[model samples]
Target: MSKETRLREEIVTVGRSLHMRGLSPGSSGNISARLDDGWLLTPTNACLGELDPGDIAKLDWEGNHLAGKPASKEAFLHHAVYAGREDSGAIVHLHCTHSAAVSCLDCLDPHSALPPLTPYFVMRVGRLPLVPYHRPGDPRLGEAISGLVGKHSAVLLANHGPLVSGKTLEAAGYAIEELEETAKLFLLLRQQPVRLLDEEQIEELRQTFGAQW
Candidate 1:
């Protein structure tokens, strides 16, 4: 298949997976992938489970609707990340339940990224900052994400959702999934007083996986 065709298929596949896994309900998430001339994005209010590959919206770097149907209303968040970080080729945003629940807690560290629950989380997600809450599709949400784009690969918006960027759409989707899993783990372990990985092990993982931030 052509590159664009493959990207469309990938987006559809990932969107369905997110819906099936309960990471995003109804039309609560948006995804986008970079293209040579512009970008392809999911449509506003489209059910991710029923997303049509051919119907994905296209836009230029400036967020102009170049082709296909109208772009996602959350398109600004995707554009902000892409414009702020050259390394980000794809972006995924999801209202996964566990992550959203954790975002509501008062004790979670807002700046520590994701906690070192597993080596995979350390390697794949690193540190995910907590961006303060903003109304859905609010311009301030994009502004908050823009500040952390160059430094972090993922962020959890307070009372909002997780936003992840990656070199590819699959990678971005995987990171967002990982974030949800990590949040689930955190909740499950919170009452048990579990032993976290030691500082030495965490440092070693950091050396091997690079910085969490």
Candidate 2:
């Protein structure tokens, strides 16, 4: 199979995983992988649980739809991150339950939304900044994500969900899963006093694992 064909299959597989696992429901998420010329993105309003590899949209680097279904409206959002972080090979944006709940909370720190609760969380999804609220599909939202590019591989959109980039499709999918799990844990332990990883320990992980903090 060609590289593009493999990428389309990867998207379908990952999207189904997210849907079955309750990370993405209805048509509330978008997934994309970088292409040599542009990108292969999940079609707009397509259900993650029902995506067909043949229906994936192909677009040029300049954003023109070349074939298949129309691209997701949030294509610009993916483009913004790719433009900002050349290292990113794929992007996953989802309205997973816990992450969206966390986004709706009023008092989260914009710099680091979630604390260092687990080593895997810290390693997979480093310091997650909470982006300011913008209406879905707004152009400004993409600009906001672009602003955090290299420094943060992931961001939780205020009143929305998590958007994560990775060096590969699987990496991006795994990071977002970690983010959602951590968000669920955060909510579960909200009322209890929990021991978060200290700065020293966090630094150690960052240095050893090269986590994007």
Candidates in order have lDDT scores of: 0.86, 0.93
- Candidate 2 per-residue lDDT, tens place, 1-42, comes to 988999999999999999998889899899999988788999
Clashing pairs in 2: none
Q: How high is each candidate's TM-score? A: 0.94, 0.98
Superposed Cα deviation of residue 172, candidate 1 (Å): 1.2
Model 1 Cα shift for residue 75 (angstroms)? 0.9
Quantify how close model 1 is to the true structure by its C-alpha RMSD in Å: 1.5
Best by lDDT: 2
- Which segments of model 2 are wrong by more than 4 Å? none
